[model samples]
Target: MTTRTPAAAVAALTLGLLLSSCALLDGSTGGDPTDAPSAQASERQRPTPPFVRQGRMSIEGGNDVTFELTVTGLEHDGEYLMLEVTHNYLEDLPGSVTGRNPPVRLVDPVSGEVLRFLHDPQSGDEPYGTHFVPGDPAMPTHEGLPTTLRRYFPAPTQDVDYLTLTGAGIGLVPGIPLTRVDAFTPAPEPNAHEYIDPETFAQEPELPDEIWYPDNPPPPGLDTADRRQTMESFVDGPTASTTRAGDQETIALHADEMFAFDDSEPTADAAQTIRAGAQTLRSHIGPRVEEITIVGHTDGVGSDTHNQTLSQERAEAARALLERELDGEFTLTIEGRGSAEPLATEGGPDDEQARARNRRVEFTYQVSPGADGSADTDGLASARRHVAEPAHFFDELEPVTTLIHDDVDLHVYPMVRDGAYAFQMVGLQNSTLSPLEADLDVDASAVPGGPAQYTQGTLGGFRVQEPDTGLIRYVVRIRTGDGEYEDFADRINELATGEQYLALAVFPAPAPDVTEMTLYAGAFGQVDVPVR
Candidate 1:
């Protein structure tokens, strides 16, 4: 994933001082020293909430760096919501390591809206988040040092009181209280090695002038306020996948079921499958939906020309059947992407399954307005709701379900619901005396493809399934402006001996009435766990 930094001028002036020890404090007492002190004392006397969340950053070439994060404030200043987070590294953060600051998002689990850092409209939509300081971007960090960073986002609804802070590598920190303040404040500095706890702070801190104010409305023509979250559903038999972002729906059909052995022609059963897809289109089509695109892809097996021609013919064949099945007059576009885009790793233990998944035809179209994004059941009968019977349902999530595979222990934790998403944490520990390449045999080919192909050593394969509805929720994906997708999970390459690394996977929230759902942990099989 590419890290989008803020504009050079703004980044250098504001974020460049991330490692500096100088504090930007406001000395103003607001006309009464006693008044300010009394306000501070009253705030300190209030019950202290859990404001600090701790996590470890596993640096690829360096030792694991433990860090504590404190959400100093998430204030809505009318125009925008400003988020202030303090990063306290327990060890020296090597300057050589870039992207020290992972991407952070404020998710309203109830609303299921994920708010990303606002981008500078003037700077070609570069996100106003992490950036490299002037000179040697890879500067070393000091131990027990507290660095504060601020990001702006579109404000959420007034009813939203708490939000979950999710960082790529830092995992999910839920239940952060949101405050509606008249003004934003700067982060308070920690005294020596001691950290400043915002929950117990007396008076509101002041923010630097540079970051407190930003251009309003984000300029004309730039669509920066779109806050729709994408919801995905994997049907039973794992036959098809549907992704809904806003009103647009993209349905991906498994080619193995549509065709047979290097054949461009649809098989006997293909008609039913195509009709199901056409039904899906007809059900979702709205007045705004003018055209639907059908694209075909093949696995990395045949030559470029052969695969390209075959993919094109297969797409055309599907189009022919879809035209007859549909009752509406809509423009249809067909294209073939030979072996360029693959949803799974071609040469791995699950090579055959990956290839079969790669051979697919996708239909992208716009659905009717006001359509429910979280609707589980779709048009296909075989792809409709069904029951998922797990092997076991643990009464207590503690004693965390540990699945041993190849001398490695993979621990699955309980699922907790936060607003519109469910958060699950899994730990991978190396039990062998020697360092081992952790291979839990997690395959994400069953899901749709994205920027990472959803298989680059990521926990994207882990999913949560509702037993009654048979609705499978894969890891949530954030769609970038370039029409690419990035998973909301951690990516691990290897594990050290006896080292237990924790990874988090975020999924779409199940029906409110459904409390117990089955967790499908790739090679570990399935287990029912209570959703808190």
Candidate 2:
């Protein structure tokens, strides 16, 4: 699975933060205007910060199903203070010949209401390819916790404050299903240290050493013991409904329970005998049975490719026997898990027991008994309401102001000195008007560290820390705030921060009316620092 951008990474991290009983993460925002130490400094002291509230929900079913929710950005919207959240889920399969499709839905933690919203699963278009063949042992497999998905709403420019997510469809690979969805209030436009000129894609950074692309890798490690094996079901049955490739409605299957079979093989005869045993168990499968998965495994004794082939053959032989024994109109999908999992220590002294365990095949059942308790509507509802807001501290500060009109994407530039610094930005809304990108405007000024020119770019949001003794002399731009450019600069400058208080107030553009305030931020964009 492709690792999502850093912002989405934060969403996953947010869940970890919530699961831990940690105190809130805090940061200061605005700077003190006066340079001198005045007597009224006591009066200007900041107010106390609110305690960040957090909650969570975990649901499991046949073929491991888990979902988690984290609340991040919280702001008042009319009568209700809305919460920006990040949602994550995992689905692991145990047995079944067919891939399972788990449905996803969002529910209100308090009211138990299934929230609604426009879902765009195909928003980001990035084609990925690999050289490994389908059954290659070296190929990355999803046998243990395979399904990984992550989505980030950089800066929500729409009216989608409250969100509820549920598992809708998942394949029957006994792999972890991991997905993350997040929400946060917008800050000033982020200070970008790097720049990729649109004209030539020439990349430069106001801060050189701080910004560099990383060699992105898939986020899984299967080369270890203690690896869990998951199975996905595949059956060649006709679709219940007529639809395109991804539109067919077929029965979703998963192993209700699981047990491992392993033992070193004295030879090929032993392996065949164990497979025969598993086939005998197939006699238990009935018409209501949707599928059965016989995933084969090896002890990594040979080359990865060779071991994968051997594992696949073992799986096929077992599958063929079960299919012939079951004799049904149901579909069958077969594949190999290669040598991703081990049932025992490969080099243990009790080699006979180890070989027996490693060479043996166990059975798991996937029965479709109409709509039983597994489909308990109440259980599903209770599970959905288990959503909660996670704790966070908005530290490290940079602010930007943007002015948008009918046309022209007014951009912003960040100020910096010699070396390197990094930052992000988010847009904060001030009214009820729908957030429109066309109406957004941005800008930057008051750069520190001379003989030093700065470059500008657009990103999600910036970070802010409490202005303490040494933190001083900095500037930011309102990266992305859409609306008629009405007193935009004044509204941005009004942002305040101190020891305890962090206020995000917006001055309405001198206009006919003001409705709501929304915010946004850039995820990875950074800034520059002075070297000399």
Candidate 3:
């Protein structure tokens, strides 16, 4: 993201200030230095400071509107943190740049935790944050003007100094300085066409309705209690992967990797893979884990009856090996899902890969409390040391690669590690004379229905893989206000010709020593991308 003030606006404001100073110095009107009229005029004409971040959004009629955002204050006020920002528009816009409820979040760069806007339970669970004032009429667009808004969020730990602001159409703005203050202070309004010196800007009177303090408790609503982190890891060779959400972990072993053709007997490598999974369970099992469930699934290829029997036999085979390896430490149960539940749409664009993923046997269990929900190093190392099959997906092109398809050009950039997440930005350009919609959604028909569904025209399918371990990292899931999880990327609709747009994709941060990984885009194949 980049930031700057309009050059023309700055020049015009500077010239006006110069003339005002000359008139005062020459005593042309014999006005007082602090005259109210002169002071008011200067205040209204004062130019705004350079914005900290800027982004462009395509509105109706294929018109692109550029929006600038400036953070005036991010202060800690005992109970919660108060955020003040100014939104500036460079030109007239037809629609609201940010809807009534903007999907904005403050991401802690150190812990990789995301903080969302607080909600008020007393008021029908309405969001505690808003850009419009209560009594003022809703103004969708200011038309070459600026609007100042305030929001509240739970404060991070004291050791943190900066956070990244993401979502709401703007690209990721990293390195936002976090300031500590005794009390919350209102942000000064910004001028759309003028540059204002920070020292000269005057603070407005505090609003009478401002009531977010300890004396007046916030509305009863959800806080950080429901906060949880989800991480996923895919083994390179065996079509095996693990997804950890809080204390629960699910290990997925592809059926194709475990069975020979349509047979239920374990393949030569199936015993070793099952043993690796058992080792992982033994390492993380707690007193609460009395039973582990192993479920088998198949792709949409075979008849329902045949798939059901095959899935059942496969689940039993996996359970048999797992039980032997565990040595009676835990009870095992098995089930056959057949072709009922899938992780991807079977007949999607990437049908082969999608079907390969769908045909899998999953081991689900709960880990010990307080245990860091991450991949078990010993278990992963054991799998790599024992399993001998090659990686299922390989990178064909190197980082900073460009792929042109369907009249749209996509430039994939190198990935950057930010705390526990890997962030990458892809540039999109429309090559045709008219607007073009990018096919970005990964087939998420398997996703349960909800507002958090990633298949709703989003970059949910973008993923990264570690070349050495073949650990594939899917886009991180975000907890929506309704408590469902969704992909943490923006929903891209269309690309306008002659306009450059950025798409953001975030995944679980790979190991510190791993400097490069392969990115799997839906139709773009694989690119060997560098990680910094």
lDDT winner: 1
Candidate 3 per-residue lDDT, tens place, 1-532, comes to: 1122222121211101111100000001111112325544633433222225555645545556665666666776665766666665676655322231125677764454677655555544443444222222222333345555556777764356556666654445554555677666644342321322222322233222221211112433336544323323223333576665545667888778788877899999898888777777877779767999999988888899999998899999999998899999988999999888877676755777777777788899886744433456646441221111111111121237787666777777666555556677676667888887777535423222111223333567666667777665667666554556667765566666756566677766666567788877766666788765
TM-score for each predicted model, relative to the true structure: 0.61, 0.22, 0.66
Tens digits of per-residue lDDT for model 1 on 1-532? Answer: 1122222111232221232211111111112111225645633333223355455554444345556666676777665677766666676543323243335567766544667666674555554543332221221233464555666777764366666666544455555556778766644332311221222212123322222222222332434466434434333335566655545667878888888979988998889887777766666679667899999999999899999998999999988988888755788899999999876667766677778878888888876753433343446532322121111111123424787777778776666665456777676777987767656577523343322343333577777777775656667776654566667776554565666666667776565567788887767667777765
- Residue 235, model 1: lDDT of 37
Write candidate 2's Cα lDDT for 398-442 as tens digits: 334443334222222221110011112222222322222212222
Q: Which of the two candidates, 2 or 3, achieves a greater lDDT against the reference?
A: 3
Go through the candidates in order and give each one's C-alpha lDDT: 0.57, 0.25, 0.56
- Candidate ordering by TM-score (highest first): 3, 1, 2
Candidate 2 at 150: error in angstroms?
Answer: 20
Task: Write down the lDDT that model 3 would get.
Answer: 0.56
